[model samples]
Target: MQKLAGVLQNFFNQAHAKGRLRRECFGNLIYYRLIDDSQPFRRGTVIFEEGTLIPGYPQIGRMIRLDKGLKEQFTKPFWAEEKVDGYNVRIFLLGERLLGVTRGGFLCPFTVDRLPDLIDERIFSDHPDFILCGEIAGPENPYLIGSPPFIKEDIQLFIFDCQRKGEFDYLSQAEKHQLMEHYSLPSVRNFGLFKAEDILAIKQLMMTLDTEGCEGLVFKEDVPRGKRSKYVTSDASLSDIQAMARYLPDFPPEYFIGRILRSVIFLDEEGISSTHELKAQLGSAFIDGLLKAIKQCQREHRVYHRFRCRLHDRANARQLLAHLARGDGHIQIVKHRLVREGEFYIFEFDKVFQRTTGLLGELLSGEMVYD
Candidate 1:
């Protein structure tokens, strides 16, 4: 018993030294959760799986509320991340050549030629040693708030994901931080996971980041799925991808039913001009978008969205189409080639997101309901 007690104490002491907290020490206690590390890191030093790799990560986009009534359906929160305003570069090895790419995945022309020898020469020769995922941030694209876009003399990389050769997830979160420090690499965060159980806290953090010019938050929890999954399940307000997709400008029509509100939503600063003068000018714009959406549906019936449609009175085809169109905060109009017969029309909100709030705002504002 004495020997066991000594061992447990030694283990806890070791964990504490490595930036872990001894949460609740009970009888013969032994357990820990990694604490946020205290250090500086560049972005892209820690890479997480993107939505494209959506497998075991069902939480990536699981759950749907297509059956909810029209009045209550437009309020789901979307699990959005700041589409980091920099080149979306990838770090991959081709045979022996490892390289970075433009957001479009192209081996950036100017970047390839001008990369500092310290970065290019080293990374190019040692490509097999690590996978570098970062952005060419400068006055071109500011990843930090209040920072202007890329500047001539100010180009650096922010590594968000770190994939070391053969070593992968073998280390605890703390160990990973230490390794990043050891390599002298710049990463996005110095800490591992920052948990926010309270919704208010979430909102505050999001607003601060948003106002500061930083992109949205990147939440990580221990949910056993991917880095982005666990939070999606534990947080219902975060998985409203479908609801937010409708207002998108270029989204497909076959994706929506009745009438299509919008083909796609743009996240530009101007955002949706609004419910701006819905009386006539804005209303006409909204109607125009809806009509166009209807015409699109008639031409193509394979939209990426799947909504539950019930044909009836209060939910009449035309009204349903109009309601859906209204939800988008934009408008689309169908031409004569599409609509035919009866006092009927098709409607589809698709995303139903508020242009002003973005999807997250709708979730917080009680505008878009989620499951």
Candidate 2:
């Protein structure tokens, strides 16, 4: 299954770029929820048969709501590492050629050229089929956050997750360290394991990285599934907002409004009592730009058609789509269709104003690394 998945991944990747595949119409990151043979439930229509590979959307957390007892949830153990404020690049060793894929699985030229030299050739030899996932960062990253330009040597490929060549299965922490040591590749700063009850301490630790212009911290489990989540800094959030405005001028009003609410939520989570302080920190220009973008989006909403998407789980899909439509009052589900394929329930949602920018955003966010 893993081998086939790898082959299919590479094939679809190249095929989609050449306009030979229609799967790109669905989204940038095609997720396949692989069903087991032993399971009683019939499998849904998916590109892959092994496991799910949903889009590259980050799992956002509620800062204030989770603060109450969320800190105690990690009493067992969790691995934390500094989140780099750079583009996500997944380097694959395919045959003799190295491909740098963006979060959306598109070939990236910038990462391919800039990062290959930094990796030791012998590491590829050891793991013939391996996926080295990391952030291509530094002052000269040339993406996302802009900083002072630096030499090529200054650019860093901070490997965070080492996975099986095509599949998303991650290597153990010890294995990752061994691989990094063998190749002499630098990694994101690791905070090791923490069992402290004080969530405030974790926040403080993240703040120190923020002082250094770092984005945030990613938490990983020690055991199976290796669930990963991130806590981003306000500075990082602001950068993302600005990037959205500068790049995606036609995005819906809901997107900007969502970010605005997030801003307020994050500020309140930080215990800021004064509205004046929050307003001053957010800046009038930033707020004004978002408001302007919202108005523009509102104007566009008046002339939109229903967007559609297919999903395997009906209830969950409705909830997720409804959640996405919250910020922008314009986007709403007009219809829902259910197709029963054996025992599986296939869901289809007709939404107002479907945009392909979701995939485009993921693609353009990083430079293509290819031949």
Candidate 3:
């Protein structure tokens, strides 16, 4: 620990001066979280005082054109897995304690509190050094406004990759599958192997998933040190626009523009004509979403996404709320947000999109913009 701290002192000092590195405590654990990329360390990198380091999850490049992207990106057979639409988190065992760290390098109290219901503790007991990377998705999640149609109620964890404590490279697909099967772990569905030339098969799969309202696929090469790329379904892009249209001003125009372009390309590539139903779906995604936002602002004087989750401990719920309060003026936790329901505590809150809320409020109240 002393040596590692010494090695990191210069970088830490520079990062601290820039307000990019943050030192936070989770109970007895003292750690440093990188709020932004600083030289060699990426944003979301977490380093513990006791020498445990959970590196930030790397961003996977997206493929807009599968035919060209596959041939250009991969030289060998690759395995395709369903890309679940949810927040990303890394779960690890720290001195017999199971903890969930979010993509932003924060120790999530909500995820930690609900870990028992998501995974078997025996996997941690067996492999204490394992860093399980996965997605936490469903309606009951506190982070996302949208959830996959498959999960009706509570959230579920789908393990997609595994890494050792000190290693940067992920385990191969087969190795990950072996461990998952042995531990009876829930994982993303695999769509089998495909070579670069298997464009027709992949297109068929993408269309099938799009029809079912599921997200796209992530293609992982089978080699020991292979690369990965992601491709989302047109429906997934539309869903994103539909869900986030209420907070449209909060996001860049590029966000919606990029999705629109992808949908157009996807439809053209699949050789599908723009039918009336398809055009109506696209139009309603924006119109309906904006209408809902307007109504919500008129009714409540705010535009926000409501989030709910279950926790085993009330203290963790408080901790989660406190952590959120430390962020920018986006999260709003009411007085009675935490309620004891049966054995577990039901925690609820709202993620307020301040820009959209303010704009809508002014417009509704007859305010005029010069621009």
Candidate 4:
């Protein structure tokens, strides 16, 4: 079944070897280069083979890190609310039509930044097998805002994952909330089966979701209380740069990502010879928001939020890679084998996977790791 033109001609006859690229062409769709240029992909993103075209989990509710002694061991009638820090979306309905992705995998190109708001895109690029993972949040969106501002953000879809029609696996957590309230899609305020004396009340409800900016709490064990582990992400950012990357010292590895980019001073401030041109126009607009926030945090594989700058030579690196390749947005080539000599400088856009190659087997799974 690999006929998409023989899977786009064996994905560009192997992306580029010797120089190690093999694929990167755009205009049709392609992407693969898993982590060469010296590995560095700390999380997830790049999910194809099921209908790619992601971006959906902006969120609205169900992030309530529950646990007051597992709330009386959750006697099966559960539902809690309000626990936001922002961003974590997903929405994909099958028998009706809807699609989105953002729990790392992106695809939203602003349409009021959609969410559980499906209108039909074939649930996401024509399906074959079933699918419908969800998350997008805000405990409840009144409207919108960003950075660190909010009057009330918005977005919430939270379905979790259904992939097939086994209705909801080995059930029980009150039968997966009566099959997510008979497919209304939004269940999990309470689904406990706790023991070990509820891990110190779910670690004090993850320190009350890190003192309310929420971002921490996940300890799955739900398979009639057994088979559902490894699913946790909530330290949304207690930020102090994780205690300064824990006592920084030679802290520039993981393919270098500390992009403050412009600052003769002011990572926290330190430079004012009569406000030297107001610190060079606030270090060139924080080095243009550190190259547009490192192309939006390496397009989702956050890589523990790193992004540095301050390079140019090579004729300002072909005019900053031809001004980030004449923007329209599309930059996810996080550090591909970077290296530099003195006065240090590195940019490595890993040729953005030759240029795009059908998104490289959904970035790394197709061709299933060289089959």
Candidate 5:
């Protein structure tokens, strides 16, 4: 363990000096997280002091044209699963403890506290070395504002992939399904298997999901370590724009532009020539979101996204707040934000986007500036 620690320390020091790594701790576990890709390691990779490495999840390329994307990307049958709208997390058993690590490699205290409510802990007991990759989504989730329409209350976990520790590849689809069934784990809804040429059927499925107000679909090849691609619905794109429009300055121009393009492509491919309703919806997404931000700033003197989550332990709630406080000074958590409600502690906070807040404040105050 000492030799491993020394080697890890040396690598972390170099990476930290180069602005590519960050070091943090939760209890007795000291870990190094990659902030940027460095040769063998991808961004969000985490390495613990005892030498457990949780590799970063790879980015899946988005496909605008289903017909061309499927043919060009997959040579074999692929499974189409619902691409949920939520923050990604990787859960694994470290010793006898189950912990949740976010995609950016941070040890999330909130997720750890809520794990039992989300999944069957016996899965970890059965497969001690398996790392569960899943999405935790709902209106009450702390990270994201958007949630699937189905989850009306607290967050829910939907396991999508599983990988063993020290292995870079995910388990085969069949293997993962078998384990999920055995454990009765909540998983992303599967739309069945499809060959590359099954574009019509896939399109029909996409339309159904869109009508049902789902995020989109992810196409994962049947084989182990197979390639993956994602395609989102027009409503999802519009919702994303609506939610983030208040903090538009915080994101790149391509963020909004890409969604617009995707929505257009989806409409065209679906052969929807009448776009009056869509145009109105898209317009309201931007206009209404910005209007709400203006009203909020006028009333509260600040603009932010309010987050609410519940934890079983009060200490974990405090710890989660502390962890968020360590971020880029945008979090606002008051003493009254953490309150006990029956058996759980409800915590609420706001993530202030200073760029948007400042910009709006200036504009509201009649400060003229050249863009």
Candidate 6:
């Protein structure tokens, strides 16, 4: 254990020294040694290697503008896979043992404990050089509201991509499917292929998934090394909006702001111009119920008088704060000050807001990228 800790510490030092890792601050959260996207992950990427756990990155999708449309984004046929609403994980075999890693390249104790039970040991033995990337979701997942609520026995790996060990290249979609079937591993739902003209159909499919309580869809190119993008569902928007205001005191303002901004993007993606249309599309009563729940939190202005937020992405946060200052009728910025603290900017603010609506609008105006 001590040796592993020392090796991990040394790895962090080297990554920092080489400028391969960065401290990315988002909202009130500070992510240490985040993967630097500028320097792409190559073979032998130094994910921590310790007792039965080797943490690494999972293939992630880029969020593109909905206005671009799926047909223009990629070539003819594209694979539209169901975007599972759960924690991202990478499962790999190390010697005789199997390990589970979070999307952030950390050893996930929950997945490490539970993933092994769902698979036959021989799968790892048979395919020693492949890393399976998927989601570890169910009741205990802290990050998302599980759709189709996973039963204990049903909470297993939902393999989406397979990458060769020590290589950035992934197996072809057909090969991946065959491998999963051969190994008896579960995979996410794949909506076969859609042509360039099938954008409307894809949109319908996304809406259908949203109605059925699924997160969204991930469109990957039919060919290898093709373009990939995701369309998040309105269900995700509703949950995020609720989390934004409900956990205001606990989570940073920018974090809340990011979620709100995503709501705006959600509107753009779904082709909804106004909130009334959104309410009707997502069910008027459902929106009312969520707004009512958030309103209760908004009414408790006295409880959250002064706040200190740590923003890692200060540039965007500042823009957002400035935008909020300009337009929002409620939520007056009583006092706003910032101090640099290493990779983070500590922001102190005093706010008095009567309605949450203004805050929500301000957030929607804030342009930020999703990781």
Give per-residue CA lDDT, model 2, range 1-371, as digits (tens).
25346655675455446544333211233333222211221122123223323222233343423255246345566788777766677676555765565654444444555554557767778786677778876543423334312222246677888766334357888889888888887788788876445567776786566556567777776666555656666655655566455223346667667667766666667665776854765564366544544454455532223323223344645444443454345445454565765544444444443342333333445746465
Q: TM-scores of all models?
A: 0.35, 0.58, 0.94, 0.25, 0.94, 0.62
Model 5 TM-score (2 dp): 0.94
Query: What lDDT is obtained when candidate 5 is compared to the true structure?
Result: 0.87
lDDT of 6 at 286: 42
Cα error, residue 73 of model 6, in Å, equals 2.0
Q: What is the number of residue pairs that collide in model 4?
A: 55
What tens-digit string does per-residue lDDT give for candidate 1 at 85-109? 3454545443444344444222332
Residues 56-106 of candidate 5 have per-residue lDDT tens digits of 878889999888889999999999999999999999988888999999899
lDDT tens digits, residue span 177-275, model 6: 898788788899999788767767877887787677677788887566777778777666665554344334334567646555666676677876567
**lDDT per residue (tens digit) for residues 211-262 in model 3:** 9889999999977658899999999998999888878877779989999999
Worst 10 residues of 2 by lDDT: 36-45
Show the lowest summed lDDT stretch of 10 residues, model 4: 34-43
- Give all candidates' CA lDDT scores: 0.34, 0.54, 0.87, 0.35, 0.87, 0.59
Report model 2's TM-score to 2 decimal places: 0.58
Deviation in Å, model 1, residue 11 alpha carbon: 46
Off by over 4 Å in 4: 1-55, 62-128, 132-160, 163-191, 194-200, 203-215, 218-236, 240-371
Clashing pairs in 6: 25-312
Go through the candidates in order and give the clash count of each. Answer: 70, 8, 0, 55, 0, 1
Error of 1 at 336 (Å): 45
